[model samples]
Target: MRCCLARRRAANSPQKTQVSLPEMKEQLSQLIQQALDALAADGRLPEATQPTIVIERTRDASHGDLASNVALTLAKAAGYKPRDLAGMICDALPASPLVSRTEVAGPGFINFFLSGDSSRAVVQRVLTEGEQFGRSNAGAGRRVQVEFVSANPTGPLHVGHGRGAAVGDSICRLLSATGWSVASEFYYNDAGAQISNLALSVQARCRGLGPDDAQWPEDGYRGDYIADVATAYLAGEKIDATDRHVAGKADPDDLDAIRDFAVAYLRREQDLDLKAFAVHFDRYFLESSLYESGEVEATVARLVANGHTYEQDGALWLRTTAFGDDKDRVMRKREGGYTYFLPDVAYHFNKWQRGFERVINEQGADHHSTVTRVRAGLQALQADIPQGWPDYVLHQMVTVMRDGSEVKLSKRAGSYVTLRDLIDEVGCDATRYFLVARAPSSQLTFDIDLALSQSNDNPVYYIQYAHARACSVRAKLAEQGWDWEQARGIAALPRLEEEQEKALIKRLDQYPEVVAGAALASEPHTVANYLRELAAEFHSYYNAHKLLVDDGELRDARIALSEAVRQVVANGLWLLGVNAPEAM
Candidate 1:
């Protein structure tokens, strides 16, 4: 079967500070629609048989700037051969200022060649838009809540958590860039068995007991950070976190005191680590608050009242199977304590009550099982919440490499590599870029040696170096006692007839579309990949031609192009939470 190509639409609302460039692909789609409409008006084609118009960029420049397969898709229904239908569609098309001409390509494909003026207009658009070049109001002020890096305060953030932070923050940035009212949240699992173990571990350490001790609490934490927490508790140190603050009682024998101090201490540590990594959360929702505020009990009561629960062998079982689970899940165990997923349902229920139309959770893959249970529990509530009301972006594990070997453990975080180690060693820019340079669904191997490299071999460096090169051109222009006027540069746009200049201009025109696509798809890596290609194009152009030429008009035009490249690179890097250095 022949595949149908999908059409692209330009964003409707553009910011006042930015000039919105028309999407050439969308313009072609509209022209195709007009042709179909004209055919329908003449009764040559049925008015009711409307096919989706698809316009795509051509693989080879000779084909055209854009191409469409609508003719091929509608040939059978239109009662015509493929190429003949293509000819009819082309013949019916109306004239447009953007598209210079159209052609019937192989197998009934319609190719569109963009006018030279239309293709080169993106440089001026880039300069006019400045920092707001790629931003669009695609979401129309919709509310979205992004919950990410929701780690328990039991320990410091590991590399896995680092990946979550980087990806989640970038997702929030993308959503904001697309004009979504985004709220970032971090869920704190500060209750349940994990906290119990953490308390016991701190208590053991406060008593001068080590992990190797026979009397050390069972299933206790073995990390040396536990010892640090214990020492802080004994010293009466004041600990402050975003949501709470506590002071150590300096009493080792008090387990409750130790637990409170330790939780606060570690939370503060995690906050510092995230701050260093340039990740921030609007709110810290604690799991313990669900029980403290009676939300968990209210959820359970509602579940029972709604006939979705039953007492089975001294335990309350939820009918998750009624919704989608393979088997029923226990809501409350025989001992009367609730399961982990119960509070999750309550938390998400709270999220719904807060008027968030869309909620996306960025979590580790380990939470895969909880996804179904949480959704099923929400369904069982019968709250009119959609079955898939909340969305998820689960990132796979990250493997850190050093000297061609897997680096598994950290001195601070006993069981896994700490996020801080990576940030401190490779710097935040490289760390953020590497963490988010790939699809979150795919496993990532972060090579420390590669990240630290300063050559073209490193993607982050290469992209940043391109921005720096553009900045250098401007500096050199100033150094040569040449004042560039925007009016002059814009007028000189006609002089940009070189192949390299045309390629760069075309690529610059696609930035807004790329931003919109990546934002809607929740794939920041798409922006990352685009930046690398864009940087390569700029670097190649810089190598082939001289920006500071003796010819006045050509020099201004080239400088204008360089400035556009710099602006776009800066804008793209800002979306990914990486720095676009003026000098690298």
Candidate 2:
């Protein structure tokens, strides 16, 4: 995680210009478009032909700031050698202040060299924009609903659910930052066979029967938390869930009452866990509501009317195979209950009706099979919903390690490590950071020892420590009777031409691009990785240069750079649902 900013040019190098990165990319694209237009005008290329102007950042700085393969892409179509076409395009390129030079490298790739001032301007931009530096209107105010951690209200949230929550909440934050009117939702499967099993489990515990007791249901949950619920129920406890409140009855034989109380009680527990992790949902959608509102039945009738469904062996079947599923799926069994897939389709249809044209469901990898089935069901409705109507982000399971072994079970959850156990042991900040610092498709190992460590090994501590160090520098400045003058710091930015200073500024400049990329890819781990690198850059800069120098201008400039680093780290951490402790 110790990332050093790219090395700066020698002092005698050519002076750099002051263009923003986004503006520079735009200018480069426009210049290439103009070049292509000139070629077409001269009959060198077809008048009706146009290609996308794609500009990408060079992986190696020696190549240039940005590069394009337009010359190579258009060579065959334009009837010229790639190199010859590149030369023609370069010749027609418009002169602009943003471009210091342009070069054609390897197989006709055009590279643009920007002035030093272009990268240096990011410092001033960061200062001017403050917390709004990396935000953009890319989403165009579109509405997007992100549903995550839709764990059934049967038990406390486990580590897998924690991963989903961290990722889902971060996605909402990322979408909001990029101009999407985002809504976070949690779908609860409150009425189902699992719920029935939960009720039986709690009822068995209420009757003084443990998992080993003969009277316990064969498939009942054996989590110790079940016992706690049973004790509370026997004492007539009132539990307030997200949507309702229910007081448990002491009647062990009343399965209906037990089911209701168990769902409400577990939901309340989940609410507390999410609150502790700083995750908030805008909506709590219930599966039972779909059935109660007649949406499920209506969905079935629509599928039948659309010729996508038929009856087989007294069960209604949807022709999911027509939509690429391996076989037809049962919408409802002969016994009268709808299968899980039907309810999912109803939920998504309801989401579409509610005006969420874009929806993302963040769930565990175990639910991968449901993706095709649900989308196929939606397609059968002929509702004009896109083939891939609702998007999915599936995260692999998380394994918690402790004392040189995997901590497989939580005493309360029985079969898995509960999220509350993690929060209680390693704290919310570390837990969230650990869960979200990797790609969702990759399995994660949540090492408790590493997370709890205060040393550099813990990324959360390392990043937070960098922020604290920056704050300490400001405090030191005041203690020495040298107040930070905003005007002076802004004016002396150009004097911050040292290699370390330029490197830090370059890292700061990358924040906007990082945010936009992460948002577009629906990967918040990109931001997490970026923050870690930014922290490393700050720490390296701090160690190499003294902030409290005798030169007033240099001191103010360094302090300004440190402050920008602090701002970015705080902003990125906020996106991850982690607190940026000022005194970590």
Candidate 3:
């Protein structure tokens, strides 16, 4: 008995048994192809062509586990009606224990039904894999850099930054989960007009000039936080940031000193807000570094040498129109200062040189106009960068709501709702979830009350409660002097044949596919939606069934199922940078 148990343990180990939904789909496709080959061999159809076999999960349970339209795709080439071809393909399918039966449905759709054992195998796989269950190697160790929340260090991080933080970090997590070597970057525009404006704003405040004062720069920032910076600067406060440290000179006339101090100070503020939001960057890329290193000049030289640039009105302009732009864009202003487009090209070229085959820039929709210009600039460089060299994920605006009205201003940030405010009020977990649960392309409306709610009406809480409830069941079982044993649970999974149990198992089986799809499509919202659906299935099953029944086998099976759900919920929440609480 001891030897037999040891053999079973060895067989169930993660390294020994690695089954995934994608692998299952591939196996089904291979089986279908074999069937098609046999049909061609027997002269029932023309020789099989090299058609791509696509397998998708059936939406309706009555159909089967997986459905393929390979027959429909190849029927015309095979000179047979689609429905007739599907029937022949089904008849030619090789016998397999994994597939209990095959059926031909509408328009040459071949559906394969898995045996009960095959369907139930996912439970064992989940238990064995634990947190690693849904992860995949689709990315194959490709290097990708996700630059986001690259907010200029002019002020604190506002709610818009919060949205980018949530989405960008989640993208990194999803990519990492799918075997992509992802670098999370926060690019800071430390040397630009924005910094100059910030310094002027501080200087005016230090000189006792308000926004209404004629001395104040036009359209200057007027937030109360500007006064705080002015006070700190006049007091000669020292500031330290990720890239630089500076001490204020207490000289309001020293505009350069104020510029350095304000940039460092606001960078620190943005850092704090990010810390509170539970987001961190692998690197803090300073835009000033590009200029300091002469990359901007080199990039312009490349553009000019490639004949994509010309002199116009005492300024150098890139023939952006050549690369599909509406018109040419100025590369360098007549004042010898390069336009923002130059530095952007330099930064992306820097990213490309860093050996990132894939680079995703997550920014607000307001930066949409720059996308065309930047890509055109890269193409002009003749670096052989793809037409769409660095991909972009532009998120729309986020509006914060409280008391049934839009709350738009933050004293800390000067003009918008601060990210720290949301984190402080609604908490890091709820704030991240609310920000990321929707598609980034859609404008998000963050309702403060909705995020703060502790009940099921809140999606985050609802999903977390499912995990906690599962934990509670195990705690209760332990309190009664019983513990879950993997051997017994595996032995008893066959007893889980109830409708709700089957439904829960089916939902759990979809997680790996969901993770791969979300990662490949760069859509973390898919995982968020999948988690909610999984939670709903678990909740329904919990409400309809008793986990600790009189039947020992059934009880063990149910507990195993609940444990799988809890594990998955925890994994899914972790992907979104949200914690899964044991009790909430």
Q: Please, what are the lDDT tens digits per residue for candidate 3 over residues 45-93?
A: 6764557899999988888889999888888888889999899888888
Q: How accurate is candidate 3 locally (lDDT)?
A: 0.88
- Colliding pairs, model 3: none
TM-score of predicted structure 3:
0.94
Per-candidate TM equals 0.94, 0.92, 0.94
**Model 2, runs deviating above 4 Å:** 1-19, 33-51, 70-94, 103-110
Q: Write the per-residue lDDT of candidate 1 for residues 1-584, one digit (tens) a residue.
A: 01111100111113211233445566677788888888888998888666788777776778987889998899888898989989988999999866789899899999988777767677877887899999999989999999999989999999999999999999999999999999999998776789979999998888899989999989899999999998888889999988789999988778788888888999999999999999989999988899999999999999999999988899999999999999999989999898887999999999999999899999989888888889999999999999887999999989999999999999988889999999999999999999999999999999999999877699999999999999998888889899897656765676799998988887898899899999888899999999999999999999999989999878988988989999999999999999888886
| Lowest lDDT 10-residue stretch of candidate 2 | 1-10
Where is model 1 more than 4 Å wrong at Cα? 1-26, 37-49
